[model samples]
Target: MVATVVQMTESKTQIQHTHRVFENQKKAFRNNPMPSSSERKENLKRLKRALLANQDRLLEAIDRDFSCRSKDESLIAEVMPSIQGINYTLKNLDSWMKPSKRHVSVLFQPASNKVHYQPKGVVGVIVPWNYPLYLAVGPLVASLAAGNRTMVKMSEFTPHTSSLFKEIIEGMFPEDLVSVITGEADVAADFSRRPFDHLLFTGSTSVGKLVMRAAAENLTPVTLELGGKSPAVVSPDVPLSDAAQRIAFGKAINAGQTCVAPDYVLCPEDRVQAFVDEFRAQASTMYPSLRDNDDYTAIINERQYDRLQSYLEDARAKGAEVIEINPANENMKDGTRKIPLTLVLNATEDMKVMQDEIFGPILPIVTYTDLDDAIHYINERPRPLALYFFGYDRAQQEHIIDQTHSGGMCINDALMHVAQDDLPFGGVGDSGMGHYHGKEGFMTFSHQRAIFSKQKFNSGKFVYAPHGTAAHKMIYKLFIR
Candidate 1:
């Protein structure tokens, strides 16, 4: 009873600190409402340098957080993208910040219309556990590029990485400009409730709804990067081996914890066995061995592990064919929390694996008779964060593009669309909303303040007051007609 009381007291104290930091960031943003391009560039440079300098330490922290996080996977999924995102922002910051000269109507002859992009005071980033570093740093890069003060709330599930991230951020930035907050779920709830100018959350759809609800208290605008069951469609004519290899790579990367990972595959009905065989071959080639293998990553924790295990159990009980691809056939029942790249065949909608976002290395293969059936299948469900189609036919590609909606898409590839620096990444409908990479990201964290200036003429006054004057009538005749 005493321990529970102490825990509550500590949580309250931490919430108070989080609130104080938020207010400080707001005050600081108000003081320096607009930061120069050079200042923002320097901030990006400092962040990149910090990440590079502490590369090994960050990877180690992540490895510790996820008991068997692959070092190569961390580099590929986390560090490289973060550095590239910063570089991309720095290179484009000046152009993005330039005031857009809008066309002034002929009636307003003496006035000029322009849109000046200004920082949206304080931005709150709620990072998810999977790919923690990249998610946190990616949004931070966008926020800094837009010259906004930022506070990142790291996930408690990744405690080791979160603690180290806080320490590194504290050393590099003053709390008023950039702060990293770390704690449990309650702390996250409190942080989301704070009145940030804008909030970006990367997590599950259910939690995203809660975050959006909290942000609504302050009428805070949000950019949600929520997860849904992203699908990979294999064209009837496409080579089964090619599609299977790419889908396997996407689903196996970071143990399928990616928000944009291929959650399921839709293949030709006759080719299901061939595609499954090819996927197993490709996965086996990638890892070769799962038990004590350094390249294959384990599930994040026991909770996630149990959840995935239950998914398999439920699917099997509901008559889905489970194919476990353990390359070496090693005993995996140990406490390593590693599950082989398992494939689910004949997945029905009622099964847990088919119904939920399978955020693990479990790929469900659903057979479709035609392309429209596949497209219709996707349309019937909630929009996904990403959709991958594997076919060389241009007409089929265009048809798919025109028919469906998703946050992003990759034709003839999977998971690579997110790495492109020029493309905007986001979700549609149930998957998520709002773009946050490339130019869209800069706009997302900025407020476009419209400005109208007049030097010596008062043309607007001609139609200002009098109801039926000659000047007003003349103005109305010119414009209304």
Candidate 2:
């Protein structure tokens, strides 16, 4: 049909335009391969100011996109962290930019070595829908701090947020410096295929594979912040009530739609009942009534709501006990897409809820016999983005820390390590790879090129290509060891 052909042509035109913008950014980067420290700082400060000024609009836009996103959650999770990351980047720019000096070996006497951090020209960032603002802004902070021009692709799931984000980005920066592109899956595909020095994507694991595959064609480096079944372990020694309360808080925020939110809780077999009871009580205290409560965020949309509902149904049909904790017992049918904090107890590996990442208000509590049993269970599965352990025993904490593999861990806490500005945040193995945040973020977007210099007092060439001599043998003997 003519319509189909027209649509294809439009898509092709958009892809060509994306390439033009990329070339412009690359040209800009070439003009100034290394931006001065003050220039980078000014850009960061301007970004901080833009975020602060548009805080209310951004929150409102996100709220519209999610239908019932909590304003407090937006402030705490999205806006606040982004500003904090910018501030952290600003605070350490000078120290990070200074070239690191390295010692030279005796054979290379009169020569010195140093490592200079330079921008990777243009970086491509693919942002996800959940925490749309933070996901985009976080990588932008890192990319800018490393003095790189960035092109960002926003998710199509959040139209309002995406448009507003594009507006805000354009207001603060020029197209060639920092640009935002709005598009569907095809656009994202085309954007990924375009060559970039480095690309960072934050989303599901399946989609991450496709993005990486596309990037591979261009040999583009990538840093994927993909999600997984990030687990929260309640140690046997820890009181059920305490662990439940902490896990409830982490899961309740953003309605458990967070990548690092405690996906499932590993409770002792005997303490499962107590954990469920405490979680309900704590969730009730946090969200007195889900229907009319602004503090409790609703599921992002009807599709996600239906997906979670199917998960609950599938688990219940498979003989798992479903405990729906509705504090007010309000009729959820009254045009609200809110699902109470439901606990799927006795969940087995066979169920879909256990197999997939539950990015909703559904929490599956898997009972474990003991500490080693819990560790083995986690080890058998693909690695998670985060691991949470609750207990006061220093020795047991050390044991878990030494035994397990995760992107990050927090002893006696859940979702707290991600807030630390000094720590590196990322995943391991199947969860994802590479690190960002703090100095690691700067390094991730930078090229740490080594520079070696020789002075006038350089030593004579001891090992020429001619024949082996006593001096060459002596030099080899002294250095090779």
Candidate 3:
């Protein structure tokens, strides 16, 4: 009973702290509501420079958290995309901020309409454990591009990298302008409950519900980037080797812990064995020795590792074929948390691996009779964050594009569309909702307020509240029709 009271008191105190931070940012935004474009650009420049200056330390911190995260992977997935996103935002902020002119109806002469993009004050970003830096920086770039103050809540699972991020944020900007908050689950809860102008969360679907429920209290607008079982469909015409190699690359990176990684593969019945062989060859060539290879990354923690193990065990018990791809036949009983590519053949709808997002180095291949069968298979499940199709047939591709539903898609390749700065990235249905990248991102954190103005005109007087008049009748007949 005593401990419960103390815990309540501490939570209340932390809530107060979060509220204070929001108030400070609110006061600062009111002081400078419309900052010049140059100021926003300067903010981006500082963030990019700081990132480049401290790239090595940040990478090391993330590696420590993941036990054996590849430095090259960090440079490619997290650092490069973040820097590129900043540059893209800097290049396009001018055009994005310009007021868009709209045509006025003939009924109202000497009137003009326009839309102005204004900042939404404070934005709260909740970062997940995977790709911590990129997820945080992506939203931060958008929020700052829209000229809003921001407060970020880094994941507790990644303490080292989160602490490093907090240090960088503190050193680069004023606390009122941009602040980083880091703690356990309770701190995250408090952070979400605060009434920010807008909120963006990138994580699993279960946690996303809690975040959204908390935001409902304050009516805070949200942009959720949740994950689901994204599927990859291989056309019959495409060579088995070609499709397998591309899917292998997407599933191998970050040990297949990526949010947009190819969750499963749909191959023709005759080609499943060939696809398996090609995938094994490709993955083996990429990771020669799983136990000692620096190129391959490990699971983030013991809980995740055990979770993947249980998934494999559950599939095996259900009579699904399990093939482990260890080129060097390395033993995993040691302290190394690394896992080889495990393919589950003959996967069925009832298997646990088929139901959940296996965010690990596990790939399941299911056989389909025709293209329509593959499309139906994808449609039966919840929409995913990403979908990949390997085929060059233009008509078939168009049919797939027109029929399938996913947040984002890539054809003839995998996981490359998210890197394109010109495209907006997001999800639909259970996967997620809303988009944020490039101009779409700028618009996400901004409010496009519609303005209507008239210049020394009395046209509106013709339709005034005075009823049963000739002018009102003529105006109604002319305009209402």
Candidate 4:
């Protein structure tokens, strides 16, 4: 019995080792300081090579974790984006690394001003389960490019992929440069509480708050990629088939687990039925059945599946017409707990589906009388992470862009806004706090230190010593005026 007890305790101890791993990484970063530009570029190159070499393994791991994540989807969404991000960083790293010169006023003519980009020591990246590899490596690539050491805490939901990634990292890089931590939420909480120089969290809003509060204890700066009820506005001018096909594809990808997925659709009252019909036809062609369709992905786990079910039930209870385009039995033996590509008509603002970020395959269609009404509806809510507008009318597109505030916007497309490395990705207000990806990611991880150099000749000494003199008064008046 004592031996069994000892074994159990040891197992628990091993399970809680993520914190220790983080501490070790922190110490390593402190010892080495910031890496040079060459080092940063080399590390990124190694990462790219590793990813290219083990592409098949990485896809398999993600598929295993997500149950039915397609190879094409994983490659397109995760691998390609990561590679593109790396290439973008590599091309601009030299310019990004250079010190930026600042203009000096005549009053301080003797001083030269500039800003230096410095690494913020070690950065902690807390990744979410969906798109685990992309989230983990994407931030890691940016942190490395910014000359900062990184400590990554992979989501426990993707254990197999996380473990494989950890193994890959151990083989390629030194632990002092990059370390991987994996465990349950307790370990994640503990990891978040650590005193890292910077922390970037990609997860839900509730969890983002916890991470923020924890980082506050250390006064650590954070970048939060949280979720919100991102909307897709279909103007009367765009073709119904095009709008429907784009929205349906975006909502169905990864079973709508994407943070930037179109949560709801806002269409003109007269075109609601036409939009619904087109959406149904497109969804049917894309996914014939929720159960055995290889293109469709299952919910991450049973809890999320049930949460989606609850939303559907709530909408139905409130007299909303719920339409399932490709309905399948919830109980199936093939490990596909597929929720239908559903549309809820007559969904009111007070309904549960509209109240929060619907992070599943359900799309709520709300009808609006005019463009102003649609804009008003979006503006009333907390700004979303992404706002998608489908229309060929340039004036209407610009109107939506000008009236609302979202982290990003895409015209005539859904979720494709995030595909551009040139654009910054994040949220505003309740959605999230900071932006990352491409150049923004580098800036997030770096500290732009304002530096000023004074020349030998004391040009501004007159203003420094005598405050009440007439000459000082004249100088001050001239400068101030």
Candidate 5:
């Protein structure tokens, strides 16, 4: 009872703080609605500097949150990308801010048309627990580059990291320019409901629906970076070792707690065993041992750990072959929340692992008789955020590219597509919607206001009124024809 009362009070306080910070940012944005390109670049540079200065602190906090998060993984996945994304934005902000010239029709001669990229007043970024630093910093970089004040909602599950992030950000940026909100689910829900010029959410698709629905109350635009069953297809002719090595790396990174991680593999029926063998060899080589491996990352929490364990049980009960690649074969029930890289063979649609996004080290191997069958299998399901195809055959590659639909693709690799600064990352259909990264990200947070101006001329007046004048007739004949 006392604990409940205290929890309620804390929730109330967090909500109040979130609301106050939001209003302050709105007011600050009103005062300087469009920051110059140099100002935006400076903001980005400050963010990068802060991240670098506190790199060790941020990494330690993330490690504490996950209980056993790998520092090397944190540096590679979180810190490096966050800094690189900021640098990318800095390099391109000037060009991205420039107004785009558009063609003016003859009917409106002596008039100029262009689109001014105006900053949206404020942006709301909801970060997920996995890859907290990168997810939060990626969108924040884009929002700042677009000249918008931002308020970020960090995942409650990552308390140590979230609190540290809030401290670091608040120490450098004023609350009116940048703020971080942290709390449990209720606070996240409240954060989603707040009115903002734009909101970007990164998490599960199920939760994305709730966020989108909340944003709709204010008709707030959103860029959702949700996850789905992203698959990697191994071509019949491609070397199984090469494909398996890349797929293993992608799945092994962050222990497969990545949105774009290869959730499953589509291989030819004849090569299923070979692919599995190669994957096991590669994954085992990377970690060598799971129990005390500093390189291996544990699942984020107990709840997530239990959820992944249940997936293995469900798959086993459904007759899927559960292969645990425990190189050292040590017991993992030591409260570390680490699960060995397990492969589920002959996964069925009825199983939970096949139905939902497997955001862990469990990779399901679904074999197909032919390439057409593989393409058909993918097309039959909801479009994935990313699809990876392995093979150098130009014709086969083009065929897959032409046949299927996904938010993004890696022809001979996996997860590397997102690291490229110039490419726009997003999803379609159930995977997600809207893009952010590169120019698309800047545009996503900016209002492309179309402008048409004319000086000392009124070409449009010819078609204004009075039963269509001769000028209007001539214009219609010229344009309508």
Candidate 6:
């Protein structure tokens, strides 16, 4: 007899491992179900405890990953938001989970209507490197609160943080109930193919399309939180310095890696120079050292650094004047590859930086003669994830909100609209596909099963036999018509 060898490929091994994990979770969920409201509250409490207990370690991991993440920023943006999400879900989950009483027409008064929110088994979350913990845990909190098992695929760019998260979570929850997978893009692709009940992804638009396509094989619902060229419009009424400070703070945070960061600035033609000056001044005060500032984070890796460099080079080559607000000094430039907090003046529509999302410290200033021109410019491109308008006039803010469509918007500020738990966070069209954050997040991961119950009595038996009779006509007119 000849001996035959069967080699197992990495993909096959991963698929099998994921299948086993899913089956185990499914079994646990079915047997020891999280159906009771009290159980869900307890689970959320445990998650909060885990986060608070490991706060320092989590911050350290993120700092190590980004090399310039500030403790204060991390706490406010990532840590606190996640904890608040958990708290919001805990307070409202009982009411959210209760079967909703639906309205019924008078003709159907004898019958009852209700919608029950049930757990969708095995929700998959694919997190991005930017705001890794918040993106991962935010969706996880919603899924768990809705009584579903969750699996997270951490980004490969932040390997250290991903590993630490896996270690921490494994110790807190069962592997089958809540697990984390850390690998490269191929692994993420494989994770997307799993037969999940629902999938949530946070990343670029190009990758969001791939995730959607992969999920289509299983007919799974997907929620994509993608980025775009979000614009910030500064009207004439707002104080230039105040507007500039807020915009600069939002854009400079995380070194412009935030998904909803303002990608470009729009202002009246007369105020363009003033806005640019204030922006440069604010950025200087905000980030004292372009190369060594702890508050200013570096690009994730060499590829992103190169991409930013290419974007600047392309804009410069195309006649756009570049302004470096705070360049790296000689002493601070020894081993650090830091791109200065820069601005691009006279940015035209054709420039590469204007055409794409400038996910870096480079800010583009575009001057417009009228508000209509600004609105037209925004409408011409794909809808953005967030829009910022800096004006004190409520009517003007309302006008902008009514005319434009975005994932979210902020008045007199930039990118802070997402912090409201009462509001849903998401993108429209090319920016992204679904919304999530408090009740919306819970509903996104849940399957609402509509149920109607009837007692053991069959009425209107005479109408079933004859469809062309007078009684049928009357019944049709009264009920159907």
Per-candidate TM equals 0.98, 0.97, 0.97, 0.95, 0.98, 0.94
Which segments of model 1 are wrong by more than 4 Å?
A: 1-3
Worst 10 contiguous positions by lDDT, candidate 5: 459-468
lDDT by residue (1-481, candidate 4, tens digit) is 9987776665466446655666776777777666778988999999999999988999999988878788888998999998999999999898988989999888888789998888888899999998998899989988998888888999889988999999999889987788888767766888888888899999999999999999999999988899899999999889999999999989989989999999999999999999988998898888767676777787888888888889989999999999887644444434467787889999987788999899999999988999999999999988899999999999998899889999888888888888798888888887888888888888899999998789688876787764789979888789786
Would you list the C-alpha lDDT of every candidate in the order shown? 0.92, 0.90, 0.93, 0.87, 0.92, 0.86
lDDT of 4 at 293: 71
Question: What's model 6's TM-score?
Answer: 0.94
Write model 1 residue lDDT over 99-179, tens digit each, in one string.
Answer: 999999989988899999999999999999999999999899999999999999999999899999999999998899999
lDDT at 346 for candidate 2?
82
Residue 279 C-alpha lDDT in model 4: 95
**Clashing residue pairs in candidate 6 (N, C-alpha, C atoms within 3 angstroms):** none
**Candidate 4 has what TM-score?**
0.95
Which residue pairs in candidate 4 collide? none
* Whole-structure CA lDDT of model 1: 0.92
Number of the top lDDT candidate: 3
Candidate scoring better on TM-score of 1 and 5:
5
> What does the lDDT read for residue 110 in candidate 5?
92
Mind giving the per-residue lDDT tens digits that candidate 6 earns over 58-142?
Answer: 9999988877677788898999999999988988998899899898665544667899899888899999998989998999999
Worst 10 residues of 4 by lDDT: 326-335
